[model samples]
Target: MKIDVHGHLSAPESLYAYKANLLAHRGAHGRGSAGVTDDTLRAALTEPNRTFGNQSHLRHLDEAGVDIQLISPRPYQMMHSEQAKLVEWFAEETNDAIARTCRIEPGRFRGIAGMPQSMETTPERWTKELRRCVTDLGFVGAMLNPDPYEGAAQPPALSDRFWYPVWEAVCELDVPVLIHSAGCRPPARESYSLHFIQEETLAVAAMLSSSVLDDFPTLKIIVSHGGGAIPYQRGRFQPGALRAGITFEERMRKLYYDTCLYTRDSIELLLRAVGTDRCLFGTEKPGTGSTRDPRTGRWVDDIHLLIEDIDWLDDGQRKQLFETNARELFRI
Candidate 1:
């Protein structure tokens, strides 16, 4: 019954074609995996050199005891990188590749399609792509970063009327709109630092403050990174949101958050703040320093400790936190 709602894979079907693309863009974290071209990308899936390939990804899933993985692309694919037209093509290709992968395992793995956030594209084209992802490709929903880029440099907020058509399609499809935290230009903060957490927190806050959910009430939104500090800061920060003519509590109730905070204490606080039904399981698999402890000879299962420490939660609550909640949220 264990399911990991957060997992990542690159487009293996076209690795060779994008090798140069990958090389040009080193990971913000300093090291980079070998980039793949179109031809080799497909080949790389079966290869071990790339950790993001199918073989490596699936191996990690099995080792983690995850029965199901809801996979999405690494952020590059999600950002609609180069431009609108190319972004559209990339979205289609990535979704198609994931659909193909899910077919091999049936219920064991699922995918969320990438959405293009380009300002240059026609609204009709954006709507059409979203329809295709939901209806034709069989994806659960779409993945979106809070802001495609950061600060004054980033494009207009996702709540802008320009994106109304896209939101309309999402509402019509009745799938969750997963808001992830990344892709900010200049990053604006260190990884896992207070500023990093604050950046995501502010993004969600801005969304709520802008009344995105109120404008599109039917669209279910899932905030990643343990709801990005929203649960903790809601009471203290909500008044400003309210004063700015936004009231998201009702809409917020419909939103869900993933448990990617990586500690029992943080997860417990989130559960209390958002409730068990609103929390889903996530490892941020291969999270920073994801290696095992060499001296203790331990695999370092974080969730195991989370379950053990939260004794107040009944058996049913634990089961819900670990598995059932995610299945229902993703409609798996």
Candidate 2:
């Protein structure tokens, strides 16, 4: 069972709904409309039967040797800056779309809900929605934007006490939270790849420096995008933690990482840093762009092939990375 833990849905109905709501009350929302136009978004959304978990997506998954995918809304669609009511509505709609997709083939798709993370949203509010997704909707997990303020206002750090309630909720529910960054507020932070890396790196560092993990000891956080440069910067963090009487590596062990790094060397580095038990297979397929691999003459977003190419990992370790870890973490 090769489970890809990172995948995204671009639901047109939800997007159009949010766009209409955002446009109707222009002054109420903080962030302006950006990115792909409605036509393009709709065109992308209308792809065959599978938006993320449909037949087309499953065909690709079969080609990549992926048995299942934990699907969530695209990060850009996680409109964290809209009014709380609208944000909640959008989240429900998005999660419903994901549920719909998963319904197409339960064996091939599982759901990860989107949260309503506006500035006005309280942890109690998050807990409510999370419970709805998990208990009623049959979702396995959720995506949380630690910085929900987006372009509207400065947001609290992931370590802030403001997020404690949400952390407690996740611990109580026994569901992992995929700590994904959303919405590029500042123009300088507009590049999706660059912003994702920056925010994920910062989120990890903040969690390390704070007591949130210690407080909710069983809480699971799977950082996306190969932990966003965290593995490469171990020299900076590990040594500093040693000086501060802390074991950085031990702290990082509590969290999980996905294989979305796009290269053999980067995945190997992550494997060495976190070990097989803490890493899961993730292609970000159909969402992440592809390029040709000169060696194989095949397009390269198929991360399963990349994992297979790693010469050092034996069959057992490969199983752990590709399937066992996800099954245990998401309880699928």
Top candidate when judged by lDDT against the true structure: 2
Top-TM-score candidate index: 2
**Candidate 2, residues 230-325: lDDT per residue as tens digits?**
889887788878988866777677789999888889899999988988998988876654455688765567788778889989999999999999
Q: What's model 2's lDDT at 183?
A: 75
lDDT of 1 by residue, 124-196 (tens): 5666766787788788867765444433255556567766776788888877766664444434454423433
Q: All candidates' TM-scores?
A: 0.77, 0.87
- In candidate 2, stretches whose alpha carbon ends up further than 4 angstroms from where it belongs are 10-18, 25-55, 244-247, 291-296
Q: How much lDDT does candidate 1 score?
A: 0.62
TM-score for model 1? 0.77
Residue 104 lDDT (model 2): 59
